[model samples]
Target: MNKKLLAGLISALLAHAAHAFDPFQIKDIRVEGIQRTEAGTVFSYLPVKVGDTMNDEKAAAAIKALFATGFFKDVRLEIDGQILVVVLEERPAIASLEFTGLKAFKPEDLKKSLRDVGLAESRIFDRAVVERAEQELKRQYLAQGHYAVQVTTTITPLERNRVGVNFSVNEGDIAKIKQINIIGAGAMSEADLLDLMVLRTSGWLTWYTKNDQYSKQKLSGDLETLRSHYLDRGYLEFNIDSTQVSISPDKQDIYITINLTEGERYTVSSVKLAGQMLLPEEELTKLVQVVPGEVFSREKMADTTKAISERLGNEGYAFANVNAAPELNKEKRQVAFTVFIDPGRRVYVRRINVSGNTRSRDEVIRREMRQVEGAWYDGEKINKSRTRVDRLGYFDEVTVETPAVAGATDQVDMEVKVKEKPTGNIMLGAGFSSAEKFTLSGSVQQQNLFGSGKHIGVQVSTSKSNQVYSLSHTDPYFTVDGVSQGFDIYTRKTDTSTLAVGSFGSDSAGGGVRWGLPIAEDDYLNVGLSIDRTTLKTDANSPLRYRNYVTTFGARSNTLLTTLGWQKDARDSLLVTTKGSLRRAVLEVSLPGSTATYVRATYQHQHFFPLDRRLTLAVNGEVGVASSYGNKDLPFFKNFYAGGIGSVRGFDSGSLGPRDTALNEAIGGDKRLIGNAELLFPVPGMGRDNSMRLSVFMDAGNVWGYDSKFSLGSLRYSGGVALAWNSPMGPLKFSYANPFNKKAEDKVQRLQFQMGSVF
Candidate 1:
């Protein structure tokens, strides 16, 4: 018999069994029709057991108990010679699940969603549950603006009462916003009001931001932005009355309308403080942003309150309350501001709890903390601690939360959670150029080794002209207080015999130890010492200057090197920085050596200014000089070279400077000067994305030999456009330049591109 019909018959028989059932004692219980489920489960759920009197009430109660288990599709009871019989039809279990045409989301994510709803693989399937899953998938699509999405399900029965469930989804086109209407704009123009919202009708740049897509969350955020816009412009009583969204018949187009009221613009009549001031009243009053006869701004008011609160927080009162409420007058269109202050008891941090560091050691994150345990809580320090952890680059996400202790009202616990990412990078890349054919390079770097916050890197490079191998390690905190120490050992060979740079080769092996001390926030002082063994090889086509130098100084030399440097970086961001300045100065010198004794000093400064939201102007300047301290001459290999990405683009790398005496080949120089300016702009399809940017830059620079004089005629000039992207593959750069003022002898590389991870 079919399970449904058999179950219905049993229910009917139970209803009629009351009239026919005589009081009788049940002897035994037997369950049937359970394939995978144990019979003991049915007996446990049964309210009546052996030796119990059989009656209509008991039979009905037993049936109700079994059905509630959700393990059975049907339950039946029968009496055969006083031996109770229980028959169960268990629901089919889901053997496997599959999805087709699910483009909006990944398969694993969808499976997880199904698992959350208890309709996944290895779980019993129910018709009602399947319908619910379908609705969920449809709603997910609609939230992303795919209103016409269609979802259908299919179940294929298998042996052993198992079934394969499949969900087929058709994620149709995203509904485009066709129209947006703003009504009830009094104090502000309708155009000005509409400009404040992110949502818009289909426009040229809609593909990037998708602002035309209809979403509930987007609408809510846009409405909030609109409210802030009016409130910041002195509209004290701005209110959004209603919002209506309509969809077309085909569901491929949507329309949004918002009605809002913008009250009269109010000017500030007076500003006063109404509460106790822990600090001087005059000092706190200065933080108040409003002044008499000025237009009232809620943004400024909130900022004033936040500033007051933070000042108290910095002073160890973490729980301070600062409020700035306004009194509005309609008749005069004037607003009165009152600042209230309540300094709560000083709180201390009980403990800082670090969690979610599955692979990272606790100390790796704790070292970044500035807030001290068992000390008075300072809000500034706590916030700084979070920023420091986030800047570590080991974690994909970092979060810090402060929650009050259960029993300690004066103490709070801070929880720091971090999600670790793949910190080790191994890169193998090859590039081909007309000058250096088939160049290959690779490196292995671990910034967070075993979660100890130490750095280790190994690098190797080979090309037709240059070869390098190096190993290095760094401890960011050799001792506390932000001191760093590191060491590097390297062997390099470079043959500058390529077309424009003269014919010479050098092999050098060296080792160095460096120490860095933090002088201030974002400023560091570095000192280092090194010893190098260098041998020069010259060819028949070598520059005349190099040949003379080899003859005079011999072919091999041992030199002692010392370096002192200071650098300060205050950029707002490492990538696509729009503001801030960077300054660096370095002095590297060779102490009296068998082959060389010279001093080289270089200074560089870079600054950027934001012209507006869409543009920034950056300028860079550098100057360097190298000269022998005594009778020794500056090493030929130590001469400063220019005409490259860092100096002058559009010219060949290391191909500009004073020429050889006879061959006219670039022999580099002992003096260097360069200046660069760039106008940064947003990429075409990338709006407000800081990971990538485009810039138009101009570069003018040159290197001068020790005997050569500094002159404007020797400077190389180039102007072009460049693109920089922090892509998934790696950091990529592409630039096109034109050297308009180049001399006939200058080697120009007009188009340049670099790819692959170079770390």
Candidate 2:
């Protein structure tokens, strides 16, 4: 009874207090309902202090200021006796974020996109904002042709009032372009109209650039290009009337319809040149591809303008401008163009700046540069520098920019930037055929030795028939004028089949020096000389020297080499190369310090054609004829032989052309001819260009007898398939071959593999 009476009394006193207390009259203030906010922060924004009066208006102002901080969900104020209290409910902070079922983009990429829109992993998460972000993500997916994408978001509360969010997504199929229609196009065929567009269905190169994949961004760019193409072609009133993109019933195919208004086709009646006459007027006129009385083609006009500008540039007018103005003759349905020229101050290169070569030495690039500091600027030289840098194969990207020097009207600075790529290579290889069981070879090479643009390498090879060790070095710019100098030291032991004997083993050591001088940009003249001593040893099983004759003989020889060759490289890369060369050498073989002479002449031709973007067809033919006219005789090692992976596949190593009864191998003849053809194509589904390739090849070659005649019937034919791979360890290759014209007793060669081979 007493508790009830007290409760009644308290209620009565609270009612009385509510009516009597004045918020404006409170002199002190405090805070309440704050879970994470500091009391001092709330008090700092309040109007009432320890000795000041407080009212509902001042409390409302404090509420607004505190709310402006964006930290609270709810705020209120109240007064009790002589004190005012502020209240706040803090918002939850984000703890974590996760995504699922996302295939079109990497997780980190999507996270970055979200962070760009103020949605990160560890910040406050709002329900309304999250819904907006989901809508945006859906729109992005749809733009990329994932029309059936689904996205769901969930939020879970964690300790300390934090919330964790997860976005589950399902990215569906990418919509394909079924058809593209151009409507209401005048003066252009439908096929031609479509040819001006970029978006298309997937084709052979689709896996390379992915340009055929449908995307809103790419479509928008294509539309812009169409608009510009028309506008620049004198279609002043052209417009895109309407564009509609529709999806098939299955939603897998898309059709685009574009309606255009091609206003009119204008003709050029007269063309006048106003550019600075750095050259004769007649010479400059020859550079203009735009002629009067021809239909105005924007592409041709642009080419003409660029040609004019480049002509001036070649004459040291580096900053020349040629603007073409179109004068319309409406009555005559014709237009006249006047090319105005503004040649800015002529400039010279004050300095050539090289950068991004943290490893390559400075002299390497400087030696290749055709341009020099303090010389008149030449656009051709600059372009050549870019090409030279690209050909080095050590850089992924190379760019040259000319930055003008302030306050120096006649001087400019050239900056070259390069991105380095890997250049070192190692090779492990093996091969086998019917004659030789197995051959093992390996090599380690650095094309750009210490980034000095020199090549140094060592190779070792061993087989049942041959063993070799070689070291070589090449200085590409030996004479500072782009001459090339090379040196090679090698030693080898090999078993050979001789004409009179069956098989024999020989050991030899030799070294040679060679030099190449550029006769023209794409032509070179090479000369080399070598001297070696060889010792031949015969075994008891030999056919000729079994019992009655000495088994060993020694010979020393000096040789002279000369060659004149021309090369043309318009191919996109060395992998698809075409080359030809002719060489003549005079060799002398005798006892050490004796005089002997022999001469040989050889010629070769090769061609490569790209059957399609993915395949290349290559053909090569070579012929060599030699005569031993002087007192000296030709060295047996200098003879020509065919029938191996490097020659005619399908047969044993050194087992083609002619046979030596004792050595049981082919000893080459004096005159030889060989020809080969191959078709190389790429395989699918590999990540990079270094994928495996397939090849079909044919080879035919033979050697003539010393006193017999050469006949086409003697040519041996072989066909086979090969596997090629541009491996990081070098070009790995393998092949299996069968001779088309084999006897019943002859066995086909086994499968063979090789590495670090040029062919």
Top lDDT prediction, candidate number = 1
Q: Write candidate 1's Cα lDDT for 1-759 as tens digits.
A: 211222333446655635445657989888889999898878888999899997766777788888888888888776777788887889999999999997779989888887777778888888998888888888778888999998889999999999999988889899999988889887678776666566777777678668789888878988988888888779888899999999999999999999988878889999898776778888888888877888887878888889889888877787889887778888999998778888888788999999988887898789889999998888889998999899889999999888888988788888998888999999887765545657789999999988889999999999888999999999988987878999999999988766468778989999999999989766899999988999999978888778888899888978898999999998888866899999999999888744688899999999999996568999999999999877777878888888756778898888898887578688888999999999998775353555678999999999988877788886889999998888766777778899979987888998877655443
- Minimum summed lDDT over a 10-residue window in model 2 is located at 1-10
CA displacement after TM-score superposition, residue 36 of candidate 2 (Å):
10
User: Distance from true position, residue 464, model 1, in Å?
Assistant: 4.7
* Model number with the top TM-score: 1
Native-vs-model 1 lDDT? 0.84
Candidate 2 lDDT, 1-759, residue by residue in tens: 111111112224444535223445656676777756678877776656787665444555566677777777877665555666665677787788788898888778777777777678666667776887788788778777787788999988988878888899988787777788889877768775565556766666555545455776777777777776775576656788888988887677888888988887687888888856667788878877778887777777888889888777766678988889989887777889998877777888899999998888888877778778988888888788888877877788899998899988888898988887777778777665445457788888888899988998899998877799999998888888988999989998887442222466778788877788777554666766665546566665554422222322233333443333334434455653423222332333222342334566666666677664356787878887765645445545566776667778887655565555544555567788889999877654231243567889998887775666778887888999988867655676688887888644233564766664321
Clashing pairs in 1: none
Error (Å) of candidate 2 at residue 493 is 8.0
Error in Å for residue 68 of model 2:
8.2
TM-scores of all models?
Answer: 0.87, 0.65
